[model samples]
Target chain A: MNAQFRRRIASAALIIGFFVAWELLCLAFNVKDIVLPRPSQIIVTLIERIPAIWPHAVQTLYTTLVGFALGIAFGVLIGVVIGSSRLAYDVAYPLLVGFSSIPKVAVVPIFVLWFGAGTVPAVLTAMILCIFPIVVNVATGLATTEPELEDVMRALKASKLDILLNVGLPRTMPYFFASLKVAVTQAFVGTVIAETVASNRGIGNLMMIASSSFDVPLVFAGLLILAALGVALYVIFSFIEMRVTGWARRKDEFALG
Target chain B: MLAPPSAPPHAETYVALERVTHTYGRDDRQVKALDETNLKIDKGDFIALVGPSGCGKSTILKLVTGLLTASSGYVFVAGREVGAEPVRVGIAFQNPTLLPWLTLRDNVMLPLKIVPPFRQEYHAKRRTEFRDRVDALLDQVGLGGFGSKYPWQLSGGMMQRASLCRALVHEPQLLMLDEPFGALDQFTREELWAIMQELWIAHRPTVLLVTHDLKEAAYLANRICVMQARPGRIIDDTIVLFPRPRTIAISFDPRFVALTQRLRELIVVASPPKDSNP
Candidate 1:
């Protein structure tokens, strides 16, 4: 078998072995359901509650996706504005750093007060949490263009915008893709936190409702489902990163374009 | 390849620096990098400026390319005053600085897509023709099949070769080299020196190469100018007078060794004495 195939199978085996050991240990220790449930019990509950759980999972996915889009659009827009101009970078960067330092969870109540307890608060929370990294990464990528390359461009009589278009934007792709991967995962976390505090729709709300009734197995299942969704979104972004920014990537990272 | 409209039909002085002095910082902390340096190159002349580090060899190159303005001198290139607007000039540095995201072909074609007269029609009916030109230039530099490869896929020497192609692709009337082959291995540097000479011979862009290597200066340039230490200015000018198609064998000739030895001794003499605080 190829090395990649062998590595994949070995990793899969380790994950499966971990769960098997966890299940056996749970029974051997006679662990209580409220504290921790066996993996098998969680799996059975997930299958039985699939129909009821699917809608909440879909709602969480929708909110996170919508908020993620908002973060990327505005984050990149603001990032480019700040990155391309020295004045904007100097003025906006400090303000952004100060703003990102404030916890998004602390601002959830404010968003709820403005938009009410629903998807709006959840989406806004996700956007607020995820936008910082995107802005910082994009701005850094655009700002750190090799000065020597800039010299070459200037010698050719290229204007600033011309240099930015031909070199700056393409150079930012790897950083941009890396930011997307991190931001997508952070978006899910933001959505869940908002739903736990202010919303009534997502898998976060479902977990809250289930735990309140002491349905411990169902709560674990909801968490597992959210994790799966997060992983799925991250994989999608990674796949697109490989396709679009292949030239910027190392061979071990993916492969040269 | 369209020539820059500014080029004069009967220009004698392609690049000239008249009493150029450049100061780096402001006020008391200011450092004079180049002090009243003067140089003039006729059309299609190839010259090398040899000096120790921080001797302002690079400052002169930057002045001619309009990367930095002279503190108090009249700099001219292609018959226009420097610092007015950027003129058509090609430059290569020690680092290839090829964009990692671009294929070698795309990297070479970059200047064409940016500079004026050619940029006006880069993507219209001239796209295929431009591609062919880039291919031809790459082939000329021993990088024929490597055009589709990205920068990382190529060795450092290959990358530098591509860089030379990129600098020349726009067909600028003047080419500047700031230690273009200094970072490569010894063998690769010698090989690239030959390639550079061939390129210069084929398309004689008025050239100015700034380097620390005396042998490199002797082997490539028609005239070698040695500079003094800090606040650099040329102290000696020696004409090589070597016949064309000059090969590596010339370095072993008695006259070649003597010339390189003399230039080396001059550099040592020009080096500043160390501080004697004891």
Candidate 2:
């Protein structure tokens, strides 16, 4: 097999082996479900209760996606402003850094206080949590445009806007997509944080309710569902990133061991 | 088919630098890159500037292209002073600088889509026409079939050839090259020199080439100017009387060797003392 296919098979085997070990270890030690539910038990619960849990899954996904989209829009706008001007970079970047360093969960309650503890609070939390990385990556991408290329554009008599659109944006795609992968995971964290604290819906709320009632398997099932959704979104974004910025990436090459 | 002549012969000088001075950095760190440098080129002339590394060969190009304003005096192109707004010029550098994301065709066609007169109607009606122009230039540079490839897919020589096509695709009145072939291997450089000669004969832009290679200056340029470092200014100007479509074999000719030798001697004289430490 080719190295890529072989590598993929190895990865799959590792994941399946981990779960198998988890199942065997739990059964051998007679582990209590309250402390750590078996993977098999979680899977069974996930399949059996999927119908009841479907709505919460949908709610969490929708909120995270909306917040992530808004985060990207605002992040790119701010990034462009800061990246294109040295004064703005010097002035605004420090404030942005300070804002980002504040633990997002701490701000979730503030969002709750203003927006009344529902989808709005969850979305705002998700957006604020994810904006920092995207802003930083986009600004870096814009800032790193090659001086030689800039000379080419300048000699063409291109305006600043033209250079940004034709050169800067294309050059920024790989960085932007990289930020998206990281930002998407952060968005999920933001949504779940707000959801568990205040919302009556979503996987986070369902998990909280299940735990309080001692439905340990159900809580594990919720965690599994969140992980699956996260992986799916990551995969989707990775695929799109590959399509949009293929030129920037090197083709895979075989290496000798 | 080649496009019609972009410039009709005119009595007025097409490019003129009148006592232009350019200083880099500010205050204590300031260094004069070019000092009261004066040059003039008639329409469709090929000129070469040869000097040591710090002699401001590139500074002169930046001024003519309007990328930088002269610290003092006037820089003129196409009968207008160059400042604030850049004058139309096609430029290439030591690096190919092709956008990795763009296909060779798209990279070459970039100028048409950006420069004003063509950009105003680039997509409306002239895309295919512009594509044809790009293809023709690529063909001239021996990169015709490779137009669909990305810059990274090509060899360094091919990329530099594409860069040349991009510079000329817009048919700017002036063509500025700053050590464009400096990075190529000897064989590749010689091959490109022949190709460059063909392109100039076909397009006839008022070409200004900057190089350290005295042979390159003698082979391609009809007029060669040698500059001195430290408050850089031209010290000698010589007109080459070689016939059109000069071949690579001409480098062996006694006259060509003498010309290059003369330019070499001038550069060595102008070079700063070897022992002087900054």
Best by DockQ: 1
* lDDT accuracy of residue A197 in candidate 2: 98
TM-score quality measure for candidate 2 = 0.95
Estimate, for each residue in B1-278, the C-alpha lDDT of model 1 and write its tens digit.
21232223465987888988999999999888889988888788889999777789999999898889888989987777975645668999999999887778889999888887889889873458888999999998899988878889889999999999988988878899999999999888888889999998888898899998888888898889999867788999977777767788989988889999999888887876652122
**Scored by CA lDDT, what does every candidate get?**
0.87, 0.88
The parts of candidate 1 lying over 4 Å away from their true place are: A1-7, A85-93, A252-257, B1-11, B83-86, B125-127, B275-278
Candidate 2 structure quality by residue, lDDT tens digits, B3-82: 22233345458889999999999999999999998899877888999998899999999889877888999988887787
List chain B TM-scores, each candidate. 0.92, 0.92
lDDT agreement of model 2 with the native: 0.88
Model 1 clashing residue pairs (backbone):
none
How well is each residue in A140-218 modelled by candidate 1, as lDDT tens digits? 8888878898899888888988988888888888899999999999999999999999878889999999999999999
lDDT (C-alpha) at residue B231 in model 2: 81
Cα miss at B183, model 1 (Å)?
Answer: 1.8
User: Which docking class does model 2 fall in?
Assistant: medium
RMSD of every candidate to native, in Å, equals: 4.3, 3.9
TM-score of chain A of 1: 0.93
